[model samples]
Target: MPFERVRLERVRLEPWKRRPELAALALLLGLLMMLHSHIPNIAGVGSLVESLLPWFGVYVPVLLAGALWRRSPSAVVALVLPVTVWLSLFGGLLTDKSHPGGDLTVVSHNVGAGNSDPSGTARQLALSGADLVALEELTDQARGTYEKGLAKAYPYHEVRGTVGLWSRLPLSDTRPVDVVQGDVGPLARTKPPESAAEAAAEVRALRTTVATEHGPLAVYVAHLGSVRVMPSQGFWTDSRDFGARALTKAVAAEPNQRMLLLGDLNGTTDDRAFHGLTSRLTSAQETAGNGFGFTWPAAFPIARIDQILVRGVRARSSWVLPETGSDHLPVGARVSW
Candidate 1:
């Protein structure tokens, strides 16, 4: 009878040994969790890996479910590493909350430039009832369309370069900020001529301040340079890294006590890229949101690239708005003094 029991135990463990894929996945999960902080600076590869980390939380559970289905003890134990890592990173998001908070309402959206239907996007954002709206990736051609579509609801608006801020409250002291795109001398000299016949368009970074009822709130709207993937290295997310650093320095220098930053940062708060902003401000979603709140490539949002960050304010509630024509989703948050 003892010999028979040993045989049964060995038989039960044999299946896990045969399924190498499960073991390999477990090993990969462990490595990712252990080395997450040491990820290389490769452009495309890095961004792709960083973007996929949040999804790992789901993958680990699915793998564990498969292990249970197969009755593999080895696989079941292997899942614990990733399960612990994922839960440690995002466990708090699972808790139930009655509501977030009550002072201010803010929204952020990328509003893809190639969007076939700007009017639809505008309508969706306007209906969100956000007190302030920040939009990025605004092209010259589509600017008027958005302005016209949003004018009725957001009476006060400001546009600096490619980014714009529209507010129901009066906006004042708006100005463009130099975000270290390139040589300042050449960029300044290349400006368009005063006369139409000799005019030539020039590139410049976008920034602005909005005067809100809460007080003079300095709002910064930015669309950082995109990171791309390549075969040689892995992924390239450096442009965003540099842009984030520059934006951070600028924000630090600003004298305003109440500040709000909204943008398609192209990275999550977990990423070190936003350390400058994250360290100083409270993420609205983190404080008051209910779910993962992913908001990129509308076909399937795997990450939350768009964000609403605040300093010297309180967040009451936050949520992702319904999708519109743009490839990105809109994120909104309500805050109080």
Candidate 2:
């Protein structure tokens, strides 16, 4: 009876030799599940999956090599589904830059707190000729340097907390926005300044009206609270989620239809936590950029946390600028009114 059981187990294992194509197909199906992140959102793993969704296309090359080695037409055929799905989702972005000529150009960057050359970074950004520049992670030490460096190009600017906005056009009605809830830090408590010049020193998120050629445009600059992944606690997105909810509510209540939001949201559009903002506004890069345009960890950008989102206005083109002193690469978008 023991010998018979061993023979049955060996027979089951040997099926791959007889039908390798079927086995490959099964593997492809599993890959498909991972590609779509069909798994449940248990303990916040689902958000992680969505964050890495674009990279799943990396598997296609490996699968193709396996199909060739096995000489299995069935295995090759099985790859078509994933290929189609991937192409359907990201193919347009791989194509050439089609749209051009924008009424306004906007740039956003999270100049790392450890940035070595704040003035140089500011100069580079100012040279981009962006009508508006939004910066996050602004430190007290580097703030004055950036302000001085950019003063020539961007005469009008505002900073609230760690986030700031610089514009070539006139700005008005600028006020600190309450995005993050819970522990209200010193960053969030900006005293009402007696003058416009000192107003930004204390602000984290700000809503300002930009006077454009077309009309007044509402622009919101924010640096949402960061998130972390801990072995014991899982994805720690509580602060980010809270800020998202608050920002969403503020944007929803805005009377202006032509609004722009630029900053380091610290979460991807695919993450459900950002649906509050994504559902209302359109991402500039997703709408018009040529490629993935990832813009974090400047050395090797794996994700795009910095964003340019617009409502009513149209994004003509969106792209990432060259590397800077900061850890995050700057992202820019050209929009038409």
User: Which residues of candidate 1, in runs, are more than 4 Å off?
Assistant: 1-27, 43-47, 69-71, 96-101, 183-205, 231-233
Q: Write the per-residue lDDT of candidate 1 for residues 207-295, one digit (tens) a residue.
A: 55666566777888877767565455445566667678888888888798788888888888878677788888888888788887899
Candidate 2 lDDT, 1-337, residue by residue in tens: 6999999988667532224665466466546544555666666677777777778778777777776666656666777777777777678778756397989999999998999999899999999999899999999899999899999999899888788899999999998887754524323334456775555553568899999989999999988877777677687666677788889999999999999999998888877888889999999988888888899879999998888999999999999999999999999999997
Evaluate model 1: give its lDDT. Answer: 0.76
| Candidate 2 similarity to native, TM-score | 0.85
Q: What is the lDDT of residue 208 in candidate 2?
A: 95
TM-score of every candidate = 0.83, 0.85
Per-residue error (Å), model 1, residue 315: 1.4
User: Best TM-score goes to which candidate?
Assistant: 2
Among all windows of 10 consecutive residues in model 1, the one with the lowest summed lDDT is: 196-205
Q: How far in Å is the alpha carbon of 119 misplaced in model 1?
A: 2.0
Global CA lDDT of candidate 2, please?
0.83
CA shift at 143, candidate 2, in angstroms?
Answer: 0.7
- Mark the regions of model 2 whose C-alpha exceeds 4 Å error after superposition: 1-38, 183-203
